[model samples]
Target chain A: MSVSRFIAAAILATALILPHADAGEVAFSERRSGSTFMAPETQAMQSNDTANPGMLGVLDGATLWGKTIGAAEKSCASCHNDASTSMSGVAARYPAFDDTLKRPVDLEQRVNLCRVDHQRAPPLAYESRELLALTALIGRQSRGLPIAGGTDPRLTPFVDKGRATFMRRQGQLNLACTNCHDDNWYKRLAGSAITQAHPTGYPLYRLEWQGLGSLQRRLRNCMVGMRAQPYDADAPEMVELELYLMSRARGMPIETPAVRP
Target chain B: MLAVAAMLGLSRAALADALRPYAIVDDAIPLSLTGADGDPARGRAVVLLRQNTCLLCHSGPFPEQRFQGDLAPNLQGTGSRWSGGQLRLRMVDASRLNPATIMPSYYRIDGLQRVAEPLRGRPILSAEQIEDVVAYLATLRDQPGKHE
Candidate 1:
């Protein structure tokens, strides 16, 4: 049978057996009571209040920022001096399309471009610990700045695609990103409540992960739960999704390396 | 290789009789109450296998089943704290009790997926499987001198 047919059959079988099945009979000893999900405001508050200990990425980025690389005999500081000054408010304007490349460029992509063109250094691996740290460091410079995506006309289509992806339902639970984040942000799902998909503060530490990760990594995790294959780290779909998320959180302050549950 | 074989043998002995084929067919198996007598040996096997996947989020006394997750509560002395019914709810469908639980319902109704058939509604575990898991959890008593 086709994959679609199999999925359909599986879903139907599940529906038929569930109603007759006993309700609230099975239990575990360590079941957590009360709300299972986090509320958006609470989630944000927690992220803001907590300090991340494993923010080694920012330190790494700081070290690399001033180091000269390749035969070009230059460093990131060669073009932009003192990130605290020149690069401040830069992260909020990202996931923007580069007119020269005709593609959207997040801060990470832009950094890699500089590495190749100016520094003559190899691009860092996507999702690598070092890359995440560099991105976090650069993003941290723009902390408290309002998100400024979608300023470029070339980014319009991607923003639309991302919005559609956010609202589209998938997975065995038949849930869309908007169902929990938009419609039920205040409601609980299992043990935690839903939080808004704010991408302003990222490359943050999560209690669940016990380490730092980028916004894209978190997005991939959600897709896994949705039972849909996630796009590759640098995939266009992911870029578009980032575009949509940044747009949604357009005015939120950037909070790189924020802590989350 | 010898150590591996020994560990597998120990696990098999712990798991063997509790999860027989008949247990799979029967939907109304008895669950062990927290204060009731329990066989920890049987519980050990149920947790180790995918039948419970409890170890997915928790760290237990078992040294061989190490995993890196803290999503669920630790199961070391769970039997002493909660009643059997509460445990059943957590395993069968955590969403009914707590909406934010990431734990999949081992047994619950179907609606999360779009479908046309009847059997593929929710989960692979039946009611009996849930009871068996509960029985295993009842054995997690704290040993007098052992603390971890």
Candidate 2:
């Protein structure tokens, strides 16, 4: 028996003994044992009572709100009023097919278009904090709305394309998003557990980035992890992908600028 | 107590005794190195120090600390699933095994650098540190269930 074989046998035995081991149970046990891998001092800070600032971008967005731009003399307030009310549920139906453009358009593109045509403001750079802040503000209006997208017929092909992109295996791991997020979500990967890949709350503030970012940015990051060439921000493929993701999270309430670990 | 100890000894002996009979080490190291002999206490220190920043991508048993990353998988029970060697390989160079892994290799023996090295030719964690982490990981096993 080789050292590897011995280890394999031991693991097999452990697995057999713990046949019913679930990630949640494992995490729970680690917590209770007081033998947790994490430091005790840090544990107190992570307790449920800790209040995370929910949406930081909203603060930046409020400042930009109603700011005038464009040659035609228009501001965001020209069309949308008191964003908390009039803009409500607007983001839930985005990444729709633009009949004129003959492609999918996300909220970001729409905002840029509004800047280009309505406000005459220069289109904000992709992945810029300004764009993310604007998107966060816009998405906040749709907070609590169910994600409702892809009802139009023209969006069908794009949705399917996005779905294919998500399911296709890429990179050195030869893994699709479905592998971990869809199939092995309950399974362990190192010390952490996987969660369902829900996009309901996006344009979120991630603990990883310690800043606000859009769902498209998150998706591109995942693509980079997948070793796949990511589509440019607000690109047709990315918009289509967002549409697919939004459709998948149809009923989940939008947690705009969500906090994620 | 003696019987239980004897049983544990027998089990260890049986595992140790079986080595070399069915042992096989291919050019590509197998992914079965669980850090059975690793020391968790040492790993904890390594995590806190500049070596391996497992905390950078995960929120784990340590929440009091800030700057822990939330993107990658957590490292609570990493020892239970991965062998010491596997963990070492992952820490040294995750891209070699999983091309898409966002993890940076602590050791660059094979000259793989996903990002520029903060310390050239120095692993984030030493071999002994890897063992310590494996020890810490082993402690994560056997806990009561809790809500994630």
Candidate 3:
């Protein structure tokens, strides 16, 4: 048998017999991570926790975690206790599959589920300040840890969908997500550098924005830049794309509330 | 873990006057032929204006813009690299050279997807805007960092 044909046969057999999650760690481009593309001062802003504005959201989150709310009169602390223990490593493994939902959910959605189902509260609005605070606070607990999740067989379908969204061309520009972040890493436009589009520092602050934002916000901004209509908040496509990004950033450390220019 | 300490002032500098205002020419003129001489000043406007957002994705010789993008080639020496003819082709349709290029064609509008409802079937940059930008870019003939 020819090598190419044998390889194809092996791949088919693997697809039939095994879940796609077992296909190994996501293949990330090693050329340059997102941080590398940042201006040096932006990097500095991210490293200094005291100076980072994202920490303000973290503080707000800490307060929210302790305050009892909802019809059940419960706080995040009521069940999780100390976030340092309960929430640690949780953020790193998000965009995980939920058996009940039968699909993947990013950390923000998971927070809403806890509010609605566990705490009997209303779901927080997407891109809300409160949501960002909680997410940043939880994410902070996982600082320095590599991104995880998307390993289960249940996530394979969503992961596949996410990959398609990332690869597919969209917008009036007809550009894919990979066009700048993947293909043009180290290249300069106007004056800013492009880096590999890793989602390590989400719920992060941006100097350009002068405020905190969710990954979805950034994605929407990219769409606007491309002159494309943005998807609605909590769109499944957003979650799916988030999953693909998390999987691609498997080994990279988390930098929630990271600062950027 | 190579942390760079960007001590250079990271102030948000807007080159508000980097580009001067100019009027658009005609669209029917042949793209291959340069019509009324493109006003470099107005061309700069098409590139640096916020409504256009070209500065958001490209860096150039605007000293006033403290923060410029680095997503594609810096426009420091674009004039020396490609001729006005070449620049026109790129402006009209960059995808013809590299289908995968992220750079949007300034003029072509056919077969685009996901465009905002308000901008359907309209090109991002008008033909006059393209010529103007090309003219301004062509003036960047010197290499970066050296005074002409």
On DockQ, the candidate that comes out on top is 3
Instruction: Name the lDDT of candidate 2.
Output: 0.61
lDDT of 2 by residue, A1-261 (tens): 344564566557546754432221123222111112224543333232234343557767866768877797877877887888877887888886777799879888888888997887799987788888888887888877877877777888988888886776654223467655554454444344455566765677666787777788888777665445566665676887789877666666676766666
Docking class of 3: acceptable
Q: Is candidate 1 or candidate 3 better by lDDT?
A: 3
| Candidate 1 lDDT over residue span A183-214, tens digit each | 44543333344456678667776778877787
Name the regions of candidate 1 deviating beyond 4 angstroms: A1-51, B1-148
Q: How accurate is candidate 1 locally (lDDT)?
A: 0.63
- Best candidate, lDDT: 3
Point out the higher-scoring one by DockQ: 2 or 3: 3
Every model's DockQ: 0.07, 0.04, 0.24
2 versus 3: better lDDT goes to = 3
In CAPRI terms, model 2 is classed as incorrect
Residues A98-143, model 3: lDDT tens digits: 8898889889999999999988999999878899999999999999
- Model 1 chain A: ten consecutive residues of lowest lDDT: A25-34
